[model samples]
Target: MDRNLIVTMNAGSSSLRCAVFERGSDSPDPLLRLSLRGLPEAMIWERKDERSGESLEEELTPPKVDSDAQAVALAEMKDRLLAEVASERIAAFSHRVVHGGRDHTAPVIATEEVMTDLDALSPLAPSHQPHNLAVIRDLSSGFPGIPQVACFDTSFHRDLAQVDRVFALPRDLSEEGIVRYGFHGLSYDHVATALDDLAPELSGGRVVVAHLGHGVSMCALRNGISVATTMGMTALDGLPMGRRPGSLDPGVVLYLIEERGMAPAQVREMLYDRCGLLGLSGISSDMNVLIQSDAPEAREAVEFFVYRCQREIGSLTAALGGIDALVLTGGLGEHVPDIRARICGGLGWLGVEIDHGANDAGETRISAPEARVPVFMIPTDEESVLARDAETVLED
Candidate 1:
């Protein structure tokens, strides 16, 4: 059998998701998917065969060593993929890079110059960019001659309005690239395309997509283009994430440094690693865990999450004049029905009403029949976006 494939990798701070897709005329055909979560301390590796609908999962304990556990996991993943498909038949390796700054508004080949430019933007997205680029570098080294493509999360919001992109700071800082460059563009891009196919009527209308997961963000798509988003110059500026404290006041940051005597690096670490659901609940960062817990702290954390999501939805709705459709994607948004119901419960004034039965059954359209705005649960496919962008770059 002819086997031409593209491998797409999305590496987060603590997890790595890789998939194999066969080259197709319209869209890439998935062959296999692999993910390694709960990294460093312990890794849970899961593999699914797209063709056979079979899955296998196991815990991977790295040998105690000074070397990086993530690198070892990536190398192991590469070996497993190679065992199934030959290196020659793998057309390209695509990646989801978290930031691209101002100039890189489109997918591009990961050349030396491109890598250098992306490296400079790492400080803006310290939690994600470093790991993403590290995976790209590792893949480039492992697959010497194969082309590596970078699909930026910021690229989809490249056309964001000037008002949406500007900060209240000095004009010179904005010119220096300290402006809103929304994250989660890959997921948003997938949802936009899916909407075009599934809800053509709502595709060209105003839409708001809530991408809730380990890293959460919302985007306002005006006729399928990002006009505004919750995230700003960094991913940390958006909705609170699994371990990130999002949208904190600038004054609080100052207070931490001046009053608390915390260094900038310490503050950054706390914001990126110790805050959010984990910090709030004093439990796991996983939303599923928080929901299952009966602790008041956990409940409050969940409530805060939903509250922030509703507020952001309202904010994005205003940005789009009004929301015609609301899309829920990402892990939590797609899986948790109660969370969805809670979020939509407060949006009744904004014409958002969801059918509890439909939502409970995990139906696609969860909105009430008499609702003015439709609510959809669309599972996002960031890998497909990466694959398509890789194909585009290869063609170019």
Candidate 2:
């Protein structure tokens, strides 16, 4: 059987997730999945074979040399993949690029010109765009002849209303692309599709999806299209994330520069790396870790996260006039029931009633039977979106 496989890569600042899907299937399942976490200092590599139902995990420490640790890991991953499946059977490589700017509103075949355009948008998404493009470059070098597809996380929100996208900045700056461009769109797209399949009735109504992972954002969808989102200009906007501060006043940046004498680079680093849950808790940024800790700071951090999510949900509900359904996705949203409960708990005014038993059991439909607004916990499948987009680019 010569299976044409599509390999999808989603790279983050300190992690990489890769999945292999057989092309041309009505609904394809990942034949093999690989994840690399805790990059640089230490690496944990895990592989799961869906066909054989086997899983393997190991820890690795890359050499202390100056070369990029993630690139080295990708090379090792390519070797393992080639060992199991011939490179000739692979059809294409798809990537989840964070910033598409204005030119890329849809998936495009990776080329020198496309890469150059994408590289210029790096400052817009400093923490993610560089890593995303680096992986694309590595795969382009390693796979040589394979078609590379660039899937944008910003594509889904490209059609947002003018009022929602523009900032209060000067017209020249907005024209230069300082407008709001929401992120985590790949995840939101997957969830929207899942909602249509799971509950077609609600899919066409007003809905709000809370993507609560390491990178957090919320979107308001009416009739399954993005109307408004919490993120603006960059991922640093919207709900607080694992490390990035969610929303901040413009004055704070000026104060850091003028009064505190912090360099622009230092401010950027603090905004992207040292804030949010870590800054709030003065500890680890992982929600799982914070949930386990008994410290007051940890408790406060979790509380602040929940509070922000609840506030955003209310804001999105208002944007939609009223929400008929609510969806929780991403890492923390899917796995952490306590967080979900706490978030929904405050949404009583919005008619979001949680069935405690259902929520605790991790059921997909967690809303109470008589609740006005239905709530669902849908696990996001971004790799599947990447694979679908890659196949489309190949067929074109």
Candidate 3:
């Protein structure tokens, strides 16, 4: 029996989330071991009230309080975590770093140089990398002696063929660290493993896992191996997300640079921050809000998102010759039944059939039993996987 406590952190552009796990005595399953979770940003947020002329309680409605910066958030979270399980009980902490480049294929205990290297990949994953590294730095400061390991989101796709990873560019450019490194592996890994646990029959077949959250991507797994993925060199490359512009036309990019006089940094902000559902709808980035909104633009944005997901689903299915199971995961995929239903609305030809009652109730299996292809709602557990990885690194 394993005797260790581990922490798994999934830090994003704005929010920092964590889960605590202790290896169970009976269950060999990673999913069952996860116990405690804390989301510092999910609870706290910032917004202004029009009537008060001053900042008021946006946190309370949703009701929360905000810490000043990443460090403060980490310190507070760590303090609370310590109260739950003493620091001495924790064997190690495993963090989810977004882009590992070609060099970092496996998880590594953190070093100053590794932190700097991860920071250098910030441009590749602007929305997630910086914050991921920040959490590492913050933890390093607060828990100086505790060992920490960095597990990357891109490591799963590291084995993609060279032809699939590069653009049609010059040799020098291709060699200069500009290439595809898919993100959200920890989540995809969760889905793949869950597929084995929940339905062993589907584990060795072709499966497309859609990770729909604030940031989104679809991974095509063949025999549980990543043959292709929607996201490329950066998180901004595929699927219109909560607030990110998926793939922009090269012509449009040139127009922004040449005519709009926008610098690369400014363009980056426009794509990474101000685009996607919020930019397209002009209402809110939240999918629930968009669904409820009667505004034409909002409805249009919702339709566009669904349509885009379908398009990619078809593309990925083709790459695998055909699809066996389509798994839905992440925040919206698991909870927002309407979105999932809409995505597979006309996908009957691909053998996807949604069970209306099960979907509405957010059950684990949302697909019709008679549906040609199985559709599953496997809520991702990246944190537990990280914890398991930490345990492996420390004790194995």
lDDT of 3 by residue, 1-396 (tens): 233667777676556566666654354332222211223334463322223434322231221455545555566556656665677766677999989998898888889988888888887877678888888887778778778899988988988888778888788988987888898999998789889989999989999999999899999998898989988888998899988988778799899999999999898888887899999998988899999999999999999999999999999999899999999999999889999999989798899999999999999889998999999999987876787677776765
Best by lDDT: 2
TM per candidate comes to 0.96, 0.96, 0.89
| Candidate achieving higher lDDT, 2 or 3 | 2
- lDDT (tens digit, per residue) of candidate 1 on 1-396: 353688999998878899988887454448889998877777898999877889999998753577776787788788877887888888899999999998899999899899999999999999889888998898889888888898999999999889999999999999988899998999999999999999999999999999988989999998899999988998888788889888989999999999999999999999889999999999989899999999999999999999999999999988889889999999888998988999999999999999999999999999999999999999999998898888788778
**In candidate 3, how many Å is residue 120 off?**
1.0
> 240, model 3: CA deviation in Å?
0.2
Q: What is the lDDT of residue 214 in candidate 3?
A: 86
Superposed by TM-score, candidate 2 places the C-alpha of residue 144 at a distance from the truth, in angstroms, of 2.1
What does candidate 2's lDDT look like per residue over 305-390, in tens digits? 99999999999999899999999999998999999999999999999999999999999999999999999999999999999999
Give the Å shift of residue 138 in candidate 3.
1.9
Model 2 compared with the native: what TM-score? 0.96
TM-score of 1: 0.96
Q: What lDDT does candidate 3 reach at residue 161?
A: 81
Between candidates 2 and 3, the one scoring higher on TM-score is 2
